[model samples]
Target: MRRTKPYFYRLLQLSIPAAMLVLAACSTTPEQTGLEPAQADEPETGLVTIVKPFPENSFHDLLVAEFAIRRQQYDLALQLYMKQAKQTGDLGVIATAARLSQFVNNEAAALQSTAHWLTLKPDAAEAHFIRATALARSRRPLEALQHMEAVIGSDQESNFATLAASALAQSEMDQQAFETAIRDLLERHPDNLNLKTGVALTLQYRNQEEEALRLIREVLTADPSNMHALLIETRVLQQLGRINEAIDRLRFAVDEYPYHKRLRLNLAQLLTRSDIFQAKAQYTVLHNQHPEDDAIRLALALVNREIGDYESAKELLRDLLARSDQRDNAHYFLGRIAEQEEAWDAAMDHYRQVSGGDQLIAALTRLAVLRSEQDGLPQARADLAAARLRFPDQDIQIYLIESDLLFEHRLYKEGFALLSGALKRHPDNTNVLYARSLFSERQKNVALMEQDLRQILSNDPDNATALNALGYSLAILTDRLNEAQTLVSKALKLRPDDPAIQDSYGWIAFRLGDLEVAENYLSRAFSQSKDHEIAAHLGEVLWRLGRREQAISVWQQGLNNKPSSTIIEETLQRLQVNLPDSE
Candidate 1:
């Protein structure tokens, strides 16, 4: 019995016809084109260039393959090309097959095709890069690194950043293979700045901030003017909770390398967290230096808006509308500005123009909200339904938005009906399931909430959100203290620093009669976030521990944080305690 290999990676849409045409055109040999004999000897001297041409006899199959691609039958196209490659032993056909297989995420076929391509053109940088990427994605880290090494000094070196990102993602899951592979690669290329920085980036992601910072400092010591090293060091410092130090580092780096766009942009972004005025000044400098760059202009506009310089922001946004690529972003920001100014008509007009780009969903949601206020909920919902048809890819988001609108209007039944319909259309979608679970909790349907959350957990057992939600719900709504403790403990282990998870853990501890443990966890959680829910928990735990004045102060702080917080009100009411309202 022959075993079939499953395809890996998500299937990308068919969008490589231009690339296919380039591959076909590059099939002509130097000899056939009457070029210099020295040019033809490039392959023998470890400088392999063009792929071998397809034989004339295989033209009919090639045409059929091209037709299959036109029909969006990528699998059929790849199969036909692979067959032609095997029959003719042609590098061109093998390269085509490899690319097609990779595009369709048929990693097994890609490996086979790339092996054949490499056999025919051993020094081909493109072939090596593709093979390394596939091997990395397949978790064959050692093999991937070997191929990656082949392309290090070649033109394909820049592409290694993508593979490094993949390695970092794997590292987050604590994959030993990638960790070993990076160490081995570093040992082989110890002095390579790119490799060192890439490894440091992975270390930074893994929360080994001290080690990551040390590596980045080594790079900076060797090349003090290195922009990448400076940026990475800032990130490491930021991760270590030294935001002011990070800002100061970027500020100094900016003074030294004033013309570097990325360095200045990063500095400006970092400054926004602490000093909006300073961030605006930096953006203004960047904008003046590169007036033609839409991204810089957009950043400057956003900073101006952040400083409440609405007129300046509007001017920059309106200017950006002249550029086709920035039009959607400009319209979206303009709509937001109008909304801030309470100019509903202008806001709707600008939102209407935002038909595409990342801001489309947000713009549509805001438009629906305004329409609901001006017209009616039904009209707003009808508009969203039309938007769902217009952007089928955002159907789930539209559905959720409509559900929120329903719940906002106290129409719980309509909200549930909408969620049920969404679940039918997108069966077992974890996001939809999670949303419905929260809605179910709102309606006090604990059984329904458990069913939905359990469905999500069954599919993704390590989902921290579902685990925490379920555990907290069980602790508050039912008497399953042991199970709640188990679930919440698991969630806390997964995300130990998360305030919400810590709050849940504290609540469970309090329920289990561990008041001291509850007080410690809840105090730390409230200190970290100052969230109303955490404050409520902390206040109750303090009250029970005979810290009455502290409990009142915590409850008052909670009310001051959010006067509309039902959590704080309910906690105080349940404990039969009354404090003066926050001024």
Candidate 2:
């Protein structure tokens, strides 16, 4: 364990509860907010005081709480902070408590606590912002919107207002309200770069993304070094799927501001959505900058795991643990890498150290998958129960993950029953709809699969994967070659040059009995992906076109990549077909 994995941590997937923005109000006293020390530290004020004047705070317990949080131990950290909050009546403590509460899916608790703080200090902008966060987490976007507006109004000049507006603009579901609030702010501060970024963001949220791009471009034209503008442009590029260009732009920006930790981190994240080489390159820079940054180091480990450098990643994480600020994170990440690498015993070793909602939810998910993978369904279920006990709010994901584990284990009836039951209850969930489509596809229930896919497509027209899935399934299942071609073309328009789309196009051509075009498209797709099914289609096309030796070689390569693919057997049968040898 040499400890230096040139990796970055996963960007904070801060649920509504875990966010510091939501917890900001309670993290400091009025004194901490630059108020009079004696007044702010008074333990008997109408408003709560998070940190007393006592020296006890800079002691071991707060450090322990911080350590637990860094290690992703939300439950234990929450317990510690919640106890402190109740005892101290400190808004800062309460805010920290609220932040931890989100990981547990305890939105009701967070709302109550944050709302109480708002009541105590009605004019406190940060308090209102925290309340907004709680409301947003609770899915009360309307209420969140009101409070977000309150936050902006309360602190008309503070950067806090901009940050609050950003959160509100990003999360509010109603396009009109989101846009109007942002427009109002921009009207007030037209030349404010931050507000302009906010307007661009709101425009993007309203799906006028190109307009948002133009706004950012206008800003960047004036100040190319505008970090916020560059960041927004990078995101727009990614959403547009110009991944290469996004990486290129971000890389240039990073070079221009090499010391900006946030810039390098953002670039690394952008790369994760790009090709493996690009992702690795961007991550390497961030990793080198923050050799001690556990987040970056963890990301490097995941990348290593993804690229089959399991031993190296594991060693890096192990070395990192001794030096990591949060030992639990080092262990958890190492465990995750181990789990993916099929080092089950080592994974469990890491998972055992985790107990809070973050760690438990993660551990439970992985252990269930592992147990199910190893013929231990009952144990997997027990792990999931433990997860629910620790983090009760994640009913949907926990159930879906369990069902998926079962499906992967070939327990189709159990998995389908679970998904079907959920669909009956929450029929409008896009994810559930997508999952049901996948289940149908796996069963080779062609009619049902197409029906669900079309349903999903109707609701989410730009669903690239769904479009590709339906197009490919149609090509493989039926002789409606022209329809398959159109569907695939639409998918390609949505996700240009996507490997899966190319594969679908090739497969459709093969189904139409056009061996030459099939060979060309299939060859392109093969270059993009080592997917077995895509290879089988191309191999068969090659064989039919009298390239038997190439077909055999392709099939062999595909089998090496994905031995479980049934299509490999079918491709071998192509050799038995009465096809003439190439001239």
lDDT, each prediction: 0.78, 0.65
Question: Candidate 1 on 293-340: residue-level lDDT in tens?
Answer: 999999989988877889999999999999999999999999999999
Whose lDDT is greatest here?
1
Q: Give candidate 1 regions above 4 Å deviation.
A: 1-141, 151-162, 171-175, 192-194, 242-257, 374-376, 511-514, 574-576
> Candidate 2, 131: how far from true, in Å?
20
Error of 1 at 374 (Å): 4.1
TM-score of each: 0.75, 0.51
lDDT of 2 by residue, 1-583 (tens): 0000000122112222333333333346532322111112322223333433423542344456656766877677767766666666666656556645644656676676667666667776665655665666654544565565565544333232243344444434464665676677667656665556667865665567788898878778887777877887877877787778877887787777887888888877766765655667767777888887777877777777678787867776787677636566667777887766678988876876665535555666676767766757887777776665666676567766776676567676666677787678677666666666666666777887788778878898887777777877776667766887888888888877777788788778777777788788889888888778777888888878888778777777777798776667755664564224323
lDDT of 1 at 308: 84
The C-alpha local distance difference test score for the whole of candidate 2 amounts to 0.65
